[model samples]
Target: MAEDIEEHEEDTPTGRKKGLLIGLVLAVVLGGGGFYAAFSGLLPIGASATHAPAPSHNADEVAFVALDPLVISLGPDRGNRHLKFAAQLEVEPHATASVSHLKPRVLDVLNSYLRAVSINELEDPSSLIRLRAQMLRRIQIVTGEGQVRDLLVTEFVLN
Candidate 1:
């Protein structure tokens, strides 16, 4: 009986050692994987020199960027229950060459769009969501297919 008890105690230590070895191995594997993932280059860097296109101006270039429209409420109270805003747009890099050709159409679109806006819509931040979509659509219509890729509001004044 004494010999059997000693044998059982010896087996218990061996089992514990095996369990500890397995746990250590698992920990090392998980730690190494986590380190590799942390160091991986999966995040995106937006609008940097590395991501943006190279700058160049050639004869085919068309640079006609009108100043942002002056937004004002044509009501009695300009400050109370009313807001005024000014917005400027940036021409797409690729469509820079064809921008001047479509200036008249672009101006017409801008005039119509600005005129259609109301003071209430300008005051609400949520209105900007629909406004951005509408602006992009209007610009696309004015410029025509593939002429403008993005509309950048360089200047935004809210009052």
Candidate 2:
């Protein structure tokens, strides 16, 4: 009986090792296939569609009034970094002239506010949004309500 069992065991080479190798090969092939499919852009289901392209607006509906660039010195010692700020005001086509005339006052307000801001706040990445809102509010106040629509920051560099 024992000799018969030993002979049966040696007759076929099917065991855990063969099944494990087959499973591993199958997994690797499927994984590679999936990667290639996604990378080739053939799998549209996996593609992201979170945002849509911005629609074109009426060009003549709004106009931008550009302000002169300002270079504000930073730090009390005056040997430290300086801020170069440039921006434009979005207003109706008719308000452009009025906004342009008040450009000097706008620059003064912006320069004063920027100088008063701490260096740490200026360096923070998230602080830009808050800073923009504050600056916009100041600009609207200076230019009077309904004259300015938005404040678009074109350049903000600290060196």
Candidate 3:
């Protein structure tokens, strides 16, 4: 009985020797892999044509800026000869170059798009979400692929 108890004790996990060895080996392999991946640039950095990061701004700061409102005149049939809808847009700070280069194009697309939208679409609350996506696509198209990161509508009011 004594001999059997001694054998059982020896067989049971009594120390951190194996665990420590495994941990060290795992750490070494993982660290080496990470270093190689980073230094070799094996990890995907991204496409060369990718847009720059958007400028970080607190919600308060964004809200503080009184943006110039865009009044798009949707042609008749909804009401009078002209129906006016309001829109606001946001561009990433890093995208300044792309935005500046394609400002005219952005404005043209925005105007045309707004002009074509039905009154009902403009009036719906959730419509702004859909409109933002549309505007983002249009802006990207105008600015060239991967130019604009996003479009934020600070204000979307139809009057």
Model 2 pairs in collision: none
TM-score on alpha carbons, each prediction: 0.45, 0.63, 0.50
Local error of candidate 2 at residue 97 (angstroms): 0.7
Model 2 — which ten-residue stretch has the worst lDDT? 44-53
**Could you tell me the TM-score of candidate 1?**
0.45
Evaluation by TM-score, superior candidate among 2 and 3: 2
Clashes (N, CA, C under 3 Å) per candidate: 0, 0, 0
Over 4 Å off in model 2, which ranges? 1-57
Q: Pairs clashing in candidate 3? A: none
Model 1 is weakest, by summed lDDT over 10 consecutive residues, at: 41-50
Most accurate candidate by lDDT:
2
lDDT per residue (tens digit) for residues 32-140 in model 3: 9977776565764433213336688765433211124566655565665353433444555565655666666677787788788877887776557677788778877
Tens-digit lDDT track for model 2 on 1-159?
999999888765666668889999999999999888876666743433222255465987889999899999997675688999999999878888999999999999999999999888999766787899899999999999999988889999989
Please write out the lDDT profile of model 1 over residues 49-138, one tens digit for every residue: 124463564635533355445454445554433234334445656766577667666656765675567867766755665686687788
Give candidate 3 misplaced runs (Cα > 4 Å): 1-68, 81-94
What are the RMSDs of all candidates, in order?
9.5, 8.8, 13.6
Error of 1 at 150 (Å): 1.3
**By lDDT: ranked, best first:** 2, 3, 1
